[model samples]
Target: MLFVEAKWLYNDALTFMNDHDINDYDSKTLTVHVLDKDRQPVTHELRYLSSQMRQSVIQGIKNNMKSLATLRKHDRKTGSLKYKSEYLSINLQQSGVTYKFYDKRHIRIQGFKKGIRIEGTNQFWNIPSLEFANAKLLNLPDGYYIAITTYQTKRSEERKYKPSIGIDMGIKTTITVSDGRKVKVLVEESERLKKCQRLIARRKKGSNNRYKAGKLLRRAYQKLGSKKRDAANKIVHELLEHERLYMQDENISGWHKGLFGRTVQHSVLGLVKAKLMKNERVTVLPKSAPTTKYCPHCGKLKKDITLFDRVYECTCGYREDRDIHAARNMILLSGLSTCGTQEINAFGEDVRHWQNSAVQPR
Candidate 1:
């Protein structure tokens, strides 16, 4: 009931915003007429959704509007927000006020009279000086989940630091680290997923069986997504343990359009790239820097390399595995290239012309 009402209110607010400015839309007096599953119009008050939930919906729309405006300001192609058919998340804007932890594994929401049982609280239960902030209630395919944001003081600890490393992302083997490590992170589709898809396709449209099949399909997708996230987190955590990281800004989207698109997608290359980019210690080289084509030994670009070549052979008698060569080049390029000269220009070359000329022998 809460999620349904939130969706209704969101669509209503979006319609109002289209006709008028967001500030002019009245949240208190606005009433939405909802329809039953049989297409009968029924009127009701905002009983299920709390005041904060309604406010969160409005704030969400406003934030999306601001984001679109920012994109337009930067000359990006923009589009209007479409009405949502389903709403699966609600934001509890305050911790102590809107929600409170009753115990280690139970919580009370604003509208509910009794506490709700929750799992996965054992990790943060016994921690000292823990502070709770805002939380989100998620309606997922498997079950309901509450994600709480908490803050705690950092504990200083003695740490062992490893040498700086570089990584090259590839479709064949997810990542190739500079220290001669090739990690494969491919989560192939399970048999259950394929069976669920087949069942969903066989069911008649608009029937209850079809609805059940659709639920199963969603659950399968959710499981697959969880596997990808777990793999990415583990890989990133291991990589960040080093003092520094060097990686290239790869063209993952272009890989999606190529012949090996499905291979790249299944391997989760994009997710790994995105996670690595967020780290403060990671330095990203330009996409046109030719990490794979440039010979690290002689500093000459080999334009004849193809995807079929697993080994990189240079005219200066330098030979190595293609992916390893690219990973090693990340370190060399990071030292030779300046921070300000990292972005490429329209000619598919670095913006700094002198840096290119300086690298070539006379």
Candidate 2:
């Protein structure tokens, strides 16, 4: 009922904002406009949406407006907000005022009469110095979820970190580290997911059975998403154990349209890239950088390398694994000319000669 009312309020605000300023819209009103089966407008009153939740709906529009304006300022194409048929999330802006946690397993949200039992609270239950902030109520196919934002003070103790390394993302071997750790990543869809998809496709459209089938399909996809996220999390955590990480900005999505679409789709390369890019310890070289083309040992560009070349062989008598070689260049070739650690040959030319400083691939 809360989410249904939220969708009504959001659509009403979007319609009103098309001609009027958002500031003039009232948030305390439970009355909203809806279209009936005859495509006629009718006044509907909300029963479960509190004033705070109502205000959040309007605030979402304001945030979208700012986002669109920012995109336009950067010369990106933009569009007006569209009306939502179903709202999936609602911001509970104030802790204790809008929502409260009764215990590790129970929580209370505004406009609800009873406290809801939640299962995932044990993940962060007894953390020291943890502070809860604003949370979002999420409506998913499986069930309702409350995503709470929490903060913890910085610990004085520093964690031990390994030596710096570079990474190379690929198709067959999902991730190849400079230290010779090649992680093959692929999570195939489960048999249940395929069955759910087939069931949904055969059901009659607009029927209750179709809706139930659709729900089952969505839940299956959710499970698949969870597996990908867990894999990405583990890989990111392991990579972050190093003191620093260097990687090139490769277009993983572009591969999805190419010959290896199925392979790319099943891999979690996109998720790994996103999570790793967020860390301060990670250094992302520009796409224009010749991470694969540059020869680290001979200090020369090997322009003849192709997709079929699994091993990088240079005429200067240096050879290495293709992905490992590229991974090594990530650490050695990136901006070496500008940094103070650059080495000079006898001819006074810039050369990359710090191979001993990097991790040797086994």
Candidate 3:
């Protein structure tokens, strides 16, 4: 579905409401839903929400603002971008809906006998996590145009593959496979995003210069997100060529909470995880499996191995790249004995039960 956003209209609405005292609203208990032309609940038309929903979402922003303020306060610094002063608006997307754009100015929300048309589409992607609630516009941001669409699948059934591989996500490297192949994703987009953010900080608040900086920052972030998603899609497509995929249940979320938060956040590991989970053929090994520390040949646990140790050296002289070792272990752990069973014993539990499960993109 295509997302349409109208920030200009939203700002105008909020400005109008704020100028007049509309204090009867509670943000926490707000929601929005779409209604058909007959005033009946619409299934796919984007739901316009009430003002209360706007207030509830603002709490998240307020908390973020407070934390940012505290950090800046401790550092003894000041800048533009007034977080608390800024208000929020809500938007929604309709599913299984259709729309026809007569002109660039407006379009229909599509579902009932008559459709709802609104203005603005310039800054659409800014809206996130759109859904429906009831028949009223619950906390929907004012003046934003909406796009209603239906999601469809291009492929009827998932394509089958014969080859299979296991992957290990890493920090220094993008991904390490059991097969000794390495893929390094570019991080230039992240660095550029940071630079844009810094530039935004230098601009004066509410000024044209500041607005320009903000636009630049938004564009940079959008580009970064797009790049990461494209890279992820390509990787998933390539990996699916194999009949099966084995991967460790690495603590990717934990990495985000750690020192390398930037790298982890920008990485497509999370996307990969989601895709794999969706596929039936991909089997995820448990988190407790010693994919890295255990020697594949001698079966000896290398307890002292550190992140810097790229090469896995065992007492039995089974030396290989650490990533390759991990990837290969996935094939062993994923024992497909009868059909195409390549049995390889692991230091952990036998994952033979997974053979019957089809691997998804996750």
Candidate 4:
């Protein structure tokens, strides 16, 4: 009843916003008419949704309008907010006031008569210094979840320092590190997922059986997403252990139109790249840096190298694996020149002389 009423409030608010000017929204006088399953309007009062929840829904609409205005200010195309067919999230504006922890395994939310039992409270139960803030109640395909924002004092810890490394993201191998390490993270579709998809396709549309199949399909996709997230987190954590990371902002999106699109998607390269890019220690080079074309040993850019060239062989007798060579260039270039440097030879190095000089600096 709570979620159903919340959805009705949200759709009603959205309809009101669309019909009237922005300056005409009034919370005191705004009333919503409920609709039955037959698509007929019926008279009803906003009895289920609390005053705070109603305000939150209206505020959400205003926030979307503000976002659209900001996009238009930046000369980008914008569109109006669409009415939501379902409302899966509700904002708990205050932690202890709107919602409160009844005990270690139960919670009480506003407008609800009974305390709801929850399962995931054990992780934060014994923490003394934890402070809870606003949270969102999420109705997912699997079950209901509450994402809480918490704050605590930072604990200082010593970290093991390792040499800086550069990474090259690819479809063949997910990541090629400058230190000759290749990590492949590919989560192939499981048999269960395929079976679920096939079952969903065979169901008739608008039937209860079809709805059940859709749920199973959603669960399968959710499982795949969890695997990708876990892999990405582990990879990013390992990369951040280094002092610095250098990578190029390759066009992973454009790879979707190529022959290896499925391979790239399944390997989760985009997720890894996104996670790494968020870290302060990671330096991203421009797309035109020519990390693959330039020879790190002789500082020469070879223009004829194609994707088929697995080995990067330069005219100056420098040879290495294509991806590793590119990864090494990322470190060398970033060490000499700042990110976004345009010239290919701006910080080119002769590998032999550079190593000798490093070994015996004058």
Q: Candidate 4: misplaced stretches above 4 Å?
A: 14-32, 43-48, 65-81, 122-128, 155-158, 293-304, 313-319, 336-362
**TM-scores of the models, in the order given:** 0.77, 0.79, 0.56, 0.79
Instruction: Please write out the lDDT profile of model 2 over residues 60-103, one tens digit for every residue.
Output: 99999999999999999998889787899999998998999887
lDDT of candidate 1 over 112-142, digit per residue (tens): 8789988888989678999999999899999
Overall lDDT per candidate, in order of appearance: 0.78, 0.81, 0.56, 0.76
| Residue 216 of model 1, lDDT score | 90
Against the true structure, what is every candidate's RMSD?
A: 6.7, 5.5, 12.4, 6.3
**Which window of 10 residues has the lowest lDDT sum in candidate 4?**
353-362
Off by over 4 Å in 1: 8-32, 45-47, 54-84, 154-159, 293-303, 314-318, 336-362
lDDT of 3 by residue, 1-362 (tens): 11211222223223333455324323423122333335564333223432333443333345554776797979966553331223332333232223444544454443334444554443433444433222222222222334343233345576667577887777653787655568775445567678878988888887888887787777677677778888888888878787777887777788877677666767787886677678887788776666677665655678898888988888777788887777776666555422122233444333334333423343
> How far out, in Å, is residue 333 in model 1?
3.4
Give the total clashing residue pairs for model 3: 34
In model 2, what is the error at residue 249, expressed in angstroms? 3.7
**Alpha-carbon runs more than 4 Å astray in model 2:** 13-26, 37-44, 62-78, 204-208, 285-305, 312-320, 334-362
Clashes of 4: 0
Model 1 TM-score is 0.77
Per-residue alpha-carbon lDDT of model 4 for 82-135, expressed as tens digits? 756678888889889878997888898888889999887888967769999998
